[model samples]
Target: MARSSTEAEYRGMAHAREIANNPVQHDRTKHVEVDRHVIKEKLDVKLVDIPLVKIQEQLADVLTQAVSASRFQDSLDKLGSGDIYAPT
Candidate 1:
């Protein structure tokens, strides 16, 4: 049976933290299935980190929707990004 998204997120959080800290064990996490190995490999190679951001502070919306000018600049500042073609 498939787990719900919330359940899967919580479950993955627990197992990922543990799996990330220990050496890879192909047979160690059989209970959680095999997908975790992909995350573990990424962690092993320093490809990413999971950081929690508040919903209001999420910047991805800037890319997906229209935002006010100030809000757009705020998001850009938060990301340390800027427009290169603006008048100097």
Candidate 2:
């Protein structure tokens, strides 16, 4: 799950730090298991980057919940889904 809040992101970083510092526990993290280490590994190796996406530009909003018409349209446009329907 992608973190949408700053607090959540901070917690994730803290967890990542713990994983890096503790070799034994890193493999046995309760919340962040071995599978989740791929992301941290990528970050450690600088292979991937986390871009700051604004809430308005979050494409998942369109599928996850109800939103204002304008916000819905914004997400749809950002995700390039506008071609699905003819313009009025």
Candidate 3:
């Protein structure tokens, strides 16, 4: 049931066109400007199909190491810090 790359790209273009035509929130004006530029630049670009892989299969060890290192650093930084401990 998966769509071909060309079909998916067509759908993505249609969705982008819809968003470009309808500017929603005031804060989105800047984003819409960027999207407009991107759309114009990519108007004639061909779609390339990139193979997809499961997250666990692709990034299991790498992500695990990154998350573990981040958590370790965060825990180290949180230990024992207070103005009350200053010499008075």
Candidate 4:
């Protein structure tokens, strides 16, 4: 569902779908969800700051997809940390 679907199809999908959907959807989304749009808006207005994520602390790869043994091990090493990918 996450890897194969087009951005438009994803927006039309359940849960991952946008709440205030338009007739035409964006080809690529700057925000992953409706609530995330707030952060994007804040970023555009310089109201929030973004923090960097260390390579070793990034665990989203596990949920994202299968990877090399080394990378999977890295993910397992830090499964409870905060999400690393910066929004907006």
Which structure among the candidates has the greatest lDDT?
A: 2
Which residue pairs collide, candidate 3? none
Cα lDDT tens digits for candidate 2, 35-59: 5788899988999999998777778
What TM-score would every model get versus the actual structure? 0.38, 0.48, 0.31, 0.41
Select the stronger candidate by lDDT from 1 and 2: 2
lDDT tens digits by residue: candidate 3, 1-88: 2145456668867776777677573346567678867776666473433468754343333323444655544544455333566698
lDDT of each: 0.73, 0.76, 0.54, 0.62
TM-score of 3: 0.31
Q: Which of 1 and 4 is the better model by lDDT?
A: 1
Q: For candidate 4, lDDT tens digit of each residue in 7-84?
A: 435655653355335434543453555558888999999999898987456677566655788778667656644436
> Which TM-score value belongs to model 1?
0.38
Residue pairs in collision within model 2: none
RMSD of each: 10.9, 7.5, 12.2, 10.9
Models ranked on TM-score: 2, 4, 1, 3
Clashes of 4: 0
Best by TM-score: 2
